[model samples]
Target: MNAIIVTGGDIDISLLENYIAENKEDIIISVDAAITKLEKINLIPHIMVGDFDTLSDDDRLKKYAELDVEIVKHDPVKDFSDSELAVDRAVKVGIKNIAVFGALGKRFDHAFANILILQKYKKLGVDITIYDKYNKIYVKSNHFILERGKLWGKYISFFSLEEKNFMEKLEGVKYPIENRIIDNIATPSLYISNEIKGDKLKATFSGDLLVVESRD
Candidate 1:
């Protein structure tokens, strides 16, 4: 089953609410302080995972406890972040597709780490996407097609995560690329701010590609 993870970070509540409404069958997971956000929307997560160090309302947690929400609490001094813990819990439950909310905000480190989690779990055969109001981020290592009308945002960008340069071909976008070498270190902005042209955008790349769909 698909899973939706709510973590402790800035989020667009209305967007999240709409997403949850549309995917009612998907599993919901709350991470620590993120419970407060879900509580505001009158949504109770199926599973809660975190250390609870940042949670402000202990009473709310107790209320979930009364309802028997499966809470997997971790030690405060743990190696993994709360977001990671929540993702791990979803993976343990055999969730192959995961969408993460509240993963981007003021804490750049946490946001970066959460983005890395997409790549980490992708190696384990799980597909994870980090989503916010304006951006959707994920990692892809193969050919993919993004339909125009259903795209997450107006602009799509790609960044190489490989150490060595790799060849890539992109089509059906404003700026199409044909067998171009993408350098991981140099010319990082070579593929930023590309807009899809017709019905769909197709990409075929050699190495790991960090894809970011964004809108201003």
Candidate 2:
């Protein structure tokens, strides 16, 4: 099944609407404080997972109660972030494809932590896409097919998620390269800002890579 986890972040409402429209079978999971956003949008989450710190008072929890949504409350001292907790719940419920919204925002550390959350999802054999107003981020360890018009953003780039050196191949991009070994010590900015040129683009890499499709 498909699922979506709405976290506490600055998200584009329009993009969120598109995500909801496209994934009709999505199980919505709202993190603390993000419940307000879902309420504003007139959408109730299927499950709510968080410490409820942003709920302000018990009255806020009442709204979720009225909706009969499943609530998984946690302690503020927990190790996993609220977003991670929600993702874990989704996985436990057998969600295969998950789109994460409100993950990119003002807090740089939180945003980066949310990006790293995808690693756990990858290990769990679940596909997750972290989306925002400008970019879509995911970890790719194998070959992937990219279509020019099917991308979320204009510029496609790859970054190393690990320190290991590996060979990579690129095709159908503005700058195509073959069997190039990426050095961990060298400048990785070389793989940045590459544009897709043909109808389809293919990427094959030996090690872990973070793929970001972004706009200007």
Candidate 3:
């Protein structure tokens, strides 16, 4: 699958290494301190974008430049955050699917902001995900399937984002909602820790649905 990885410095190197190992052919985009994770793992990224304020090591930055990795330098005084810069870089690269790491869990504000940023990519037809040590968070359009995870430790949760009809159909979960309208800011109290019993768990909603997979 064609994928882009945007790094944000809050990475567990081992976890990042393991996840990207399967998607080796996917483009690697490192942002800010996230570049250091690549340097630590002795891997070169395809694109490194962010303000270099966090990375004080001149030698580390120079090595990637010498290795010919595409670097997009931005001003620290910009309106957008560094992670957004990396996300933009990924879009410019024209990848339809993106998996972002270290974008969550480093800071609460960043994770919340990342959720809001998800809206921008939806219009572009890009499927983006924000993943961390214990969670892989994403959004599903009106219609999608929820099959059992290939790996263990993935518990799913659903939320409605700025829409009234968030959970139109939820099957195989302990609590199932069929054709319901939920508010955008509604608390995701009902959809949590649900397991898929059948071959596929199908959901069709009228508006945006936020899906969170928390691994145990």
Candidate 4:
């Protein structure tokens, strides 16, 4: 099954609506305060996971309980973040594809940590993509083909997620590169802000790479 984990962060209502419209059959997991956002959209979460720090409304909690939503409450001092727990629940339930929403917000550290959660599930072959108002982020370790008009934004940036050196190549972009070695330990910003130029954008890279497709 596929899943959409909503975290407590800056959420784009339009993006959230689009995701819901597209992934209607997928399971929805609400992480803490994200439930409030879902409530506004008239979306009843399939599973609720968090410490209840942001879910302080007693009536809402009672309503959720009456609706039989699977609630997995955690401690305030737990090691893993609420977002991580939510994604882990999805993975455990045999979800192969996961799309995270409302992950970026005022809390920069939480936002960054939520973005890096992609790496945890990447090794398990779970295709995870984080969708915010201005960006779609995921980790890539092999060949990728991105069509020009289908991209969410005009700019695509690649960064190494490892400490080793590897080769990378980009084609069908404004700034194309041959077989360039990317040394993560030394120079990490070698591949940045490459715009799609033609019909398709092709990328082949060794080692772990984080791809960020962004807009203005």
Best by lDDT: 1
Deviating ranges (above 4 Å) for candidate 4: none
TM-score of each: 0.96, 0.95, 0.90, 0.94
Q: On residues 1-216, what C-alpha lDDT tens digit does candidate 4 reach at each position?
A: 899999998899878978899879999999998998898889899999999887777687778888999888899899999999999999987998999998888999998898788877898888899999899999887788999888889899887777653556788999897777766656667677889998999887776778899999
lDDT per residue, candidate 1, 6-29, as tens digits? 998899999999999999999999
C-alpha-based local distance difference test score of model 2? 0.85
* Candidate 2 per-residue lDDT over residues 126-205, each given as its tens digit: 88999989999988776888899998777988877776546467899998978776555586687878899999889888
Residue 96 lDDT (model 3): 78
lDDT of 4: 0.86
Ranking of candidates on TM-score, top first = 1, 2, 4, 3
Worst 10 residues of 4 by lDDT: 160-169
Instruction: Give the Cα RMSD of candidate 4.
Output: 1.4
Which is the winner by lDDT between candidate 1 and candidate 4? 1
lDDT scores in order:
0.89, 0.85, 0.74, 0.86
lDDT of 3: 0.74
- How many Å off is the CA of 164 in candidate 1? 3.9
Off by over 4 Å in 2: none
Of the candidates numbered 3 and 4, which has the greater lDDT value?
4
